[model samples]
Target: MHVVAIYNNKGGEGKSTVTVGIAEFLAANRNKKVLVVDLDAQASSSCALLGRQSLNAAIREGRTVVDLAAQLKQTRRPSIDPEQFLVWRAASEARGSALESMAMLVPDGDRMYDVESSMVWGKHNHLFRDWLKPKLTEFDFVLIDLPANVTKSAMVCVNGLAMSDFVLIPTRSTHISLNGLPRTFSLIDQVRNVNGDGFPTVLGFLLNATDKRNQQYRSIVRPMVAASTDGEIPPFFQNHWPASPALEAATDEDRDARTLKERFGNAYDHARKVARELEVACEKYERTQVQPIKLSLWQRLGLA
Candidate 1:
């Protein structure tokens, strides 16, 4: 299975939207068996796959990503039984496209017990990897939607990245969000150093919610793109997701392809293009056996 983590340190950078969109594209278009793990506390990705109202009620009952992970770890497998931590979202269609849904699979009866022991003694606290190993062959892709900021919840994402083949960083053209990229990169490097192998490659940095009309967008993004080629920064996604009001509206109505095409215009086309690029990157990284570069303490502190 190919694990892909869609992450960004800054919120409102369209991380969840891009994560869901890519998973939907892969599942419906490429006929790939995709599993989307919602690691965000807000459960936006879960809500998007399920429904806002249904997720709202789930949250009210304190059902969240943490609970789900804990339960799975405790059982040392995907939970098979339904509980507060497990929710099976019925697959729904929008614009003739089917949304990817999740079924909670608890492997054993000791859902809580296994997770606790793993945290205390397992290597790298990677209980998620141990739980997912048995089921990975069942899917072509596993997409994880991470929390906005680097926190304990975010570490789970890093653990996921350690198993992933690629990592996609989604961000807007704003300075603050863009500035967070280095730190995110540092975290990925840390995971790579710890794992010693199977570290996810930086597939590409995706520019989301970009405004073509804004002069600042060009000014900032142009330099960033140049920096990538100049070796000052890593390469980014060639296809950018421009701001589209229609996308938000379509998502609200749960309209799939037709709505996405109408709202996003050429954005989806670009997304596919970028996804292809990511595939190429993954192949190259695997073939070359590239190792992640470590950063100094000052570099990680964002002061370098």
Candidate 2:
């Protein structure tokens, strides 16, 4: 299975929304088995998918990622297998698909699973890598929705990236958000260094919540496109995910009665385009081939 992390250092950059959108697209349209691990304490992704408030609620009242790890380390007791901890639920029945048909495994419980700051590192440092070795053939992808900032949860995100084949960085086309790219990239570098694996290559930097009419967006897009041409960053720049009222509306209410494909036609169309780009990136990465140049570094750096 290919693993992908939807990450960015800044919050409200549409990271969680993009992550859930992609998971839904893959599961509902591609008919692939998906596992979404919500490592954030906020449980936004978990709520979007399973309607669970937190990860702890799914693990029964007595267990947590930390509790299991401590038990395993302190008492030499075998902790709960990661697979058993999965909460299985159907995707929205509005699409006429069973929960089992979409996600093969999800976090199980009612409260939310919160990753404490202390438990973020080394809970299963190499455990995910080892655990995924045998089960890699079971699914098409394992998508993780990381917390917004570089905290302990972010470190767990890096661990997920270590095991993943590609990483997608979602950002807005603005001075403040774009300015923080270096730090986010640095975090990825640190994760790769710690794991002794090369940095997790970006699938692409997705420009989200963009307004076509804005002069600022055009200004930003021009330079970013130039950078892709110059090879300052990987050339897997996907299509922009336009800002839409439908996205917010879908997020606010349960439209599960309608297939995501049917409820928001325009939004799903954009998501499908993004998914197509992702497939190409995944294919090239899997084969260890270089991505073709599409834009210049000047454009990528937003200096064009």
Candidate 3:
């Protein structure tokens, strides 16, 4: 399975929206089996994918990421019964397209926010890699919608990023969002530099809530992103998500749309177009492997 993380340091940058859109496009249009991992304590993606009522039901029924994490913490062992957390008929689970596919692992921000972080992040930070990497072999694609803050609620999501084959950075054209990219890039570098370990390739930036008429996006943001196309930094996607109520409303469940076209309305075309481009980018990333990190102090000391 191709594991992709839709991530950004700052919130309200359309991370969840982009995640659900691409996930739906892949599952509904491309016939790919998908699993959406909601890694936020707020559980926004969960509500978006399954609706608030359904998410509450899942939480009450002990079928959330909190329950799964609790299972491991109580036993003092790391394990993953993905089924326990898997939500059936998620946003991507198009009707009659696939079997019990396109499931979601809803987060428990209330219970798991600071609750699980302090307990699980021991010396070994491979909380997700240790378990999730193996179980992920079951799907065609695993997409993680990570929370905005890393340390507060979900450091485990870092391991998710660590195990990902591709990292999808969804950003707005604003300076606030663009300013945070340096730190994000630094974090990715630090992780990848560990004993020359393999890391996910940035699958290019997906511009969200863009206005074609804006000179900032057309002249400044677009040019900056194009210039960022070094070997390590990813280029921007050709298609962008337009700012529209229809696109935002698509995040709301019970839209009752049968296909990607019906759901995203006018933006459906660009959404599908971006999804196809992402598929190709991931394929290219798979072919071009990341270079190993040079030995660190630990590796030199025979510790790593």
Candidate 4:
């Protein structure tokens, strides 16, 4: 499976929206089986995919990431049932029966905060990675909606990056969001230094909520992102998500399921284009065989 982490260090950068959009497009249009692991304590992706009522049900039934982490904290072995944790047909997108293959690991922010606070990273890191890998083998793509404040939830963020094949940074076309790219890159570098070859390579930035009329996006934010990377422009997707009422409205989910066309409306084309770019980006990494971290027998047996 191609494990992709939709991440940005700064909040309100449309990470969850991008995660749900790309995941739905892949599963609904590209005929790919997707598993969205909601790593954000906010659980925004979980709610967007399953709707609020379903997400609340999952949280109540202990079918959240918090449950998985709490279980892992008490066990050295993979005792938790992965299938039980997954919510099938999670996206509720009525498109060609492909969304039927989509699933998610819902999250509860309140419980997640407690779990993160209690987590002993050194002890749980590899165990969490080993446990999650096998559960995700059935998927074509595993998209993790990572938390914004990585410092506040360092344990989960570190292991999430460790398990990912690519890290796709989603940023808004603004000063605050674009300026945070350097810090995000620094954190990725630190993770690479810690995990070495196992760390995920940057999959480039997906500029969200772009306004074609605004030249500032091109004139200002573009240069800022380039400067952050030491004068070399980062790989930005050619197709950006345009600012639109339809796109903004699509981010909010209700009890009703909607087709991609119905939900995204005119912004459907924008989503499709960005999703296509994402697919093309993954192909290069796959050909190069950017391997995710695999547990050795010693590590699996808790010897390493």
On the 0 to 100 scale, the lDDT of residue 196 in model 1 is: 67
Q: Candidate 1: list runs displaced more than 4 Å.
A: 53-68, 71-124, 152-155, 212-214, 250-267, 287-304
Candidate that scores best on lDDT: 4
lDDT tens readout by residue for model 3, 3-73: 89998877788988898888888877787888888878777677766778878888889887767655655
**After superposing candidate 2, which stretches have Cα over 4 Å from the reference?**
53-80, 91-100, 104-124, 152-155, 253-258, 262-265, 287-304
In candidate 4, stretches whose alpha carbon ends up further than 4 angstroms from where it belongs are 90-101, 224-233, 255-257, 287-304
Q: Per-residue lDDT of 1-304 in model 4, one digit per residue for the tens? A: 7888888888888888899889888988887888898888777777777778888888889888788877877775767778888887644435543344578988787777787777755555555567877767888889999887786246766677767878899888876666676667666666665565645777878888887468868675655445436524346777899878777776677624467776677988999889878988888766342223222422432223
Per-candidate TM equals: 0.74, 0.79, 0.84, 0.86
**What lDDT does each candidate get?**
0.60, 0.61, 0.71, 0.74
> Taking the candidates one at a time, how many backbone clashes does each contain?
14, 34, 2, 0
Candidate 1 residue lDDT tens string, 211-288: 757986776667767756765455777777777764454345254333335434556676556556655565665533
- Please give me the total number of clashing residue pairs in predicted model 1: 14
RMSD of each: 5.5, 4.7, 6.3, 7.9
After superposition, the stretches of candidate 3 with alpha carbons farther than 4 Å from their true spots are: 73-79, 90-101, 120-122, 194-196, 230-232, 287-304
Among the numbered candidates, top TM-score falls to 4
Q: Model 1 reaches what TM-score against the true structure?
A: 0.74
> lDDT tens string, model 2, 257-298?
346655445687888678667766777777342232233533
